[model samples]
Target: MLIIPAENAVNWKRPPWVTLGLIMTCLLVFLFYQGGDSRLLDRAVEQYLDDGLLELEAPVYEDYLSREIRLQGRSDRVYDLQAFQQAREGGEPFWLAVSLLSDPEFYQYMTDNRDLLLAPAQRADWLARRVPIQEELIGRLSAFRFGLVPARLDVYTLVTYQFLHGGWGHIIGNLLFLFLLGYTVEKALGPGRFLLAYLVCGVLSGLVYTGFSLGSQVPLVGASGSISGLMGMYVAIYGLRKIRFFYFIGFYFNYFRAPALALLPVWLGKEIYDYWFAGATGIAYMAHAGGLLAGAGLVWLLGKSWFQVRESFFEPDESALDDRFTTGYAQAMGSLERMEFELARHQFEALRQHYPGRLIVLEHLYQLARLRPDLPRFRELARELMAEAANHHQPERMVAVWQEYLAEGESFTPLEAEDHNRVLFASLRHNDLKAAEKAFERLRQLGNDVLTSEACRLLASEFDKRQMSGRARYYQQLMQA
Candidate 1:
């Protein structure tokens, strides 16, 4: 009794959700262009700041001091305070412009405080202090109904404000996160939705920051606030999904996977720790907090039900059977090719027994049965296979298999001249004259013309070898006839 291993048994199939998830992830990666050292924003900023011609405001000049700055070299003046006020009362872009222009001494003060503004924390605090100006700007813009005149809104601070940042580290850090998280959210929401989410998040984060900070003059830029919203959505939707993360502690490199939900606490904890202990790092803990909350709230309100439906579709089915017979057949063929006859026999037998109506298995079983001619069980199997084959289209293969076994079992050629003729020729070729003579007599009794001629030729050769000239000549004349 042979026992096949359990591992060899047919198993369950992979769920379709696995394939769908892989395709979604791949599309996200392609759209985002993830996995690289990203510095496009930095280069853009550098280009805008480096031009030698513009007499930029002192604060703007000081904010970019010692950094690679590239400027577009375009400047305009606000002659109308009501227009500025009107612009402020308008949309986000207008409000952004009003905040910049509202404080005339803002530029001078920043230039004077350049050293203090070098740190991210100080810069964030400085921007935070300007909350009242930003609020007034927002109020004025609201009063104007977000600049109903398209031209007025187009030229406002909203267009340029997003371009500013606290420091180089702040810009680069935010960009990295944006590139990583933005792409995924973009794929889920589409380009239009992604852009909308980004703008809304930025505006919301700015509102929160401005509300909390009151009356300081500092410029804020970069995409952190918006990207934080994406992160929140990612955590909410893919909470149970595993994400591979890389981190380094001192000189040691570590890699691991954790549920997406688990990362939230870790990120929040780190921000809080850094806020109090790491002074003057210039990071915006409050902005990060505001962005996170805003992102989560927005996505929850608008997309929670959809996310739940998507999650339901993504769940893998564990109870499904693989049901792929071709794989098993391939395995059997591989065993057959390796000359693992016993294994092949067992596989073919199981296939025949379990899938009796399958003609292909019956054919394979017939071939295997022919190999074991000495076994009575094989004879019965071969007869059954032949009977099955007769009912099918091609009976030749089954007939050939049966002949091979029959030939192996019985050798009655000695009594049948026509059948024994081949034996006579073979014996003669090997110089077995006695065996040849016995075969020739059988051919003579049969009176088969072709065999008789062949037998006479052999007899003449034998007579000549024995020096019987008369008998050789007589047989030679018969061969001539």
Candidate 2:
């Protein structure tokens, strides 16, 4: 089963150039470092194979068996090197010997054999023994020097490790996730902060992996940890938003929409569950979890901190425009408070120019029209608002606007029979006698079915409360007829 995000639920103001640049860098590094499919993992696995040499230069299998048998509790069962070597060739002996090696217990062993197992010199020696595959020695030879190995970690490998990939599939999968999640995160944090956070998260992930894989000699390479950080940031920023994800289980596929934060626990839980249950599948789940935590922490700090941030790195900047718009909006509100009708009207007009199709601006203008009672803009704003509400399927909003327009002692706009009857019944419910009576007259003119026996009965009660006994009796007699 796989779940993939299609796009973000919320739209941001800027493009994701920083994310794009990161993807390009990862691709370039992959092509440059392992373009020939250097078979580096193949060579690493080969070193673990038994070569039938008990006493010889670099007896890799025998050295492994002696150390394993001595470290494992089965040391009493093995009497000599030959016996241990023979058992090492069998499946049962191999698993029993390597069990501790896969765990943290093997850390001391790897530390003691650092010169033979973890050093670049040993890797170079191994490569030298093989027939040169390429004339240019530029590829797998660099993984050991740059990749992060918990057993032999150099300070520089923390950042360098993220730029390397074990294979094309590894790099491609990481890049896909990076592009999907990083774009939104970069836009949220802006470019400069995004880059810094990414590198920091990657470093944190490497540290977490080092803590977990203490004795492991295999070099961890890939941008998954950093990309996981982006996923974390994406969740933090859009946590409350209802985002859509495409999910597939075998041949069945469907889409799910849920709060963006909902997936965070699901993802983190999966990683933790896999770490305990799935064993190692060449994946650094601890590193992924660490990066996710680090990214969320950094985002929280950045959002809540008092530090002044630099300008965002996206082009066609809108920050200044947004500030100006906010200031202008405040001024418009202040003008209304001061009863500067013409001034407020002018400000609302200016706002409408910038915020065309914005209902709030139109609403303010509609209020100005009602207060002035002479401006033709009131009718114009009313017509626009009603149409806008109708198009948006906001029937309640439409009723509200119509009622407000009628309260201004304006004629109701020509509406369909259903809408007219709805407004009439709503006005009656609110005890807006004047609006309801006007709506009723309009309904009568349209010859709608609104004047049924039930309607007449309800209107009679409302009329009797208002002391309109003659109108009440008129409706009552009509109901009888």
Candidate 3:
């Protein structure tokens, strides 16, 4: 089964150059440096063979003399010494002969018998060993010498091992996860802390892996352990935010959603299960688990503020409409908060046509109108809100609608009149005199509507009780009108 968290869909900051740089460095090292080493070793072996300085005995001798190792793309195809000798003559390129040196038995025999084969000057070359010629030693040196070895811990291996991957698939898998999790993590922790956290997590994980697998000769390579640390940090940083996850098991495929931290236990549990039962698969599950713990522990130390900064991770949207809506709305709101009035106005206006029905959008437009009261958009937004509120039967919303509309020196429409009466009667029935009074004035604007007579009478009575005869007479005239 494969499961992954839903990637973030919005990026609020710059691209993660550090993560990209690390990936590129790993790619270059694998493709150019490590790959070229094998070819160089082949050349060195061929030169020694052509000069007749190299000799071998039966088994090892005939093996190097006749064995064929053909390079097919990135793979090696081996041919038995007898069959290869019959098929090809001695005139073949020296490098083909050199390829035979890769055989562990042949490489061992040559290393052990270097003294018999080498002249005094050649002895210096053998002793210097600048070029790795021993197949077993080369493999071991590539892994244990540079890669992290639990049995022989070296401080440099902690960081270097993260850059050395066993194969293309290994590096690609590590970088994919590093990109997904690392980008956001870098943003949360900031570039400096992000680097620190990454290395620290990797080192801590390596230490833990070494502690558990003590005395084991296997060398751990790849960024999986460090990326696992990022995963742990991801969980801690996101905390309670609902994160979507994608999963596949055999033919089954689906998605699930849960609070970000909820998956932490699931991930750790899988690693533990694999480490104990699937040891033969050759994965360093111990390192992965350790990295996870180290990452989470580091984030816990950083506290909640770091997590808050992580919300900017972007997961590009598949739907164009959603992208525009979210992007535009966010930009508009963000601009307003920053007091960037011109940009906020532009964003608000752009969204006005597309999101005219959204209450939140309309509310923001109304706010813009209050700030720039003369702007026609405010009145338009207020009108749209009034109609929407009426359709939804939201009396409280009409309060702003009326306020905005009236502040713009506009009279109530017939629908506005009906809504005013709804509020007026509801308020009077609920004994909210303040609200009833506010509604009474708007109700007065709807002359000859269904509730006008009762509203006028109510206003006149209230004025008379307050001993305000002049206002009472005005309402009496409105009643006659």
How far out, in Å, is residue 141 in model 3? Answer: 5.1
For candidate 1, the lDDT comes to: 0.52
Please report, as a residue range, the 10-residue window in candidate 1 with the lowest summed lDDT: 1-10
Order the candidate numbers by TM-score, best to worst: 2, 3, 1
State each model's CA lDDT, in order. 0.52, 0.68, 0.70
Candidate no. 1 TM-score: 0.35
Q: Report the lDDT tens digits of candidate 1 across residue range 1-481.
A: 1110010111124222322332344334323432111233232223323431112333353343313122522121223333444544564342333344434334445646756644665555445444333344322332122211212332344323443443446556656556556655655555555566666766666565555544433334445666666666666555577755566677776666667667666665665676556544435565565666666666677775423224322333333212434666778899999999889888877766655677787778767765655666666665566556555634454444445544763232123454456556555555656666665666777788887997898789878998989878988998898
lDDT tens digits, residues 1-481, model 3?
A: 7777655642545778777777788888778656755555555565556544343222345544443333222112233454445434564545345445444445555666778755677766655552344433345445545788776788999998888877778878888888877777877777877887888888999998999877655678888888899899888877787778888899999988899888889999999998776634658888999999999888887656543344444333458767888998999989999999878878987897776656777777667766654656656666677667756767566665665566553632233576667667655554555676778777766564658888878877877877989878988898898
**In lDDT terms, how accurate is model 3?**
0.70
Choose the strongest candidate by lDDT.
3
What TM-score would every model get versus the actual structure? 0.35, 0.50, 0.50
lDDT of 1 at 191: 52
For residues 1-481, write the lDDT of model 2, one tens digit per residue.
6776555532445558888888898888888756644445344324333431112222444565576677764352244456544555664434433332222323344435656764575544434432132112312455656889797889999999898887768888888888887876766666787898889889998998899888667678888888888777766665587767878899999998888778878888888888776643668899999888877666667755521133442223357767877888999999989999899989989988876756787878877787754556666777677677766666567678877766673653345455556666766766666666666666666665545555667788989988999989988887787
Candidate 2 positional error at 420, Å: 50
Better of 2 and 3 by lDDT: 3
Count of backbone clashes for each model?
A: 29, 0, 7
lDDT value, residue 228 of candidate 2? 82
Q: Name the TM-score of candidate 3.
A: 0.50
